[model samples]
Target: MHEMSLCENILQTLQQQANAQQYSKVKTIWLEIGELAGVEADALRFSFDSVMQDSIADQARLEIIDIAGQAYCSHCAKNVPIQQRYDACPECGHFPLQIVAGDQMRIKQLEVE
Candidate 1:
């Protein structure tokens, strides 16, 4: 799964931050993941534990914050919440709403020692 690679990248980032901030351990990781990011949270959690084994973030608690997707509907001339990429505008039932947010995955906060 791509979540394995994503965890690897997270580990790499943690290692780099550890060096820069002079922290020795990571206690908790708070991740902000958008609904449209296409990442499976369960898969990511499993991969994180495997990837962080014996590393600075070993045994770290992971907290995932889900972000709702947002889109602008040209037909309705308003912004609306969306669950999927191809969701139609709720007000006007227009196809292909322009995405305005909820397409990112990032580390929001970290508790380190």
Candidate 2:
């Protein structure tokens, strides 16, 4: 899956940060993965272990925070939570809502020494 590549990219970024900051080792990585980000957490975690083998991030602990999908309905003028995309507005049953949240895959924090 694409999670492997994503993990590789994250490791690369972390390596750069560590080298720049002169950190000895990474301890933990806190991540926020939105529901609409289309990333599978378990798959990503597995990929992380696979890709980090023998690397600087091999012992890094991964903490994932899952965020619910949200959308702003133009017709209803309110924010609504959704389980999936293509779900209509909860207030007014409309399609093509402007998504307000839950479309991000970002690193929130890092624990390093």
Q: Itemize residue pairs with steric clashes in candidate 1.
A: none
lDDT per residue for candidate 2 within 10-32, as digits (tens), equals: 99999998889989687899999
Candidate 2: list runs displaced more than 4 Å: none
Model 1 TM-score is: 0.91
> Across residues 1-113, which tens digit of lDDT does each residue of candidate 1 receive?
89999999999999999999999999999999899999999999989998999999999999999999999998888899999988899878998899988888899999998
Clashes of each: 0, 0
TM-score of 2: 0.92
- What TM-scores do the predictions have? 0.91, 0.92
Global CA lDDT computed for model 1: 0.93
**Model 1 worst lDDT window (10 residues):** 83-92
Superposed Cα deviation of residue 23, candidate 2 (Å)? 1.4
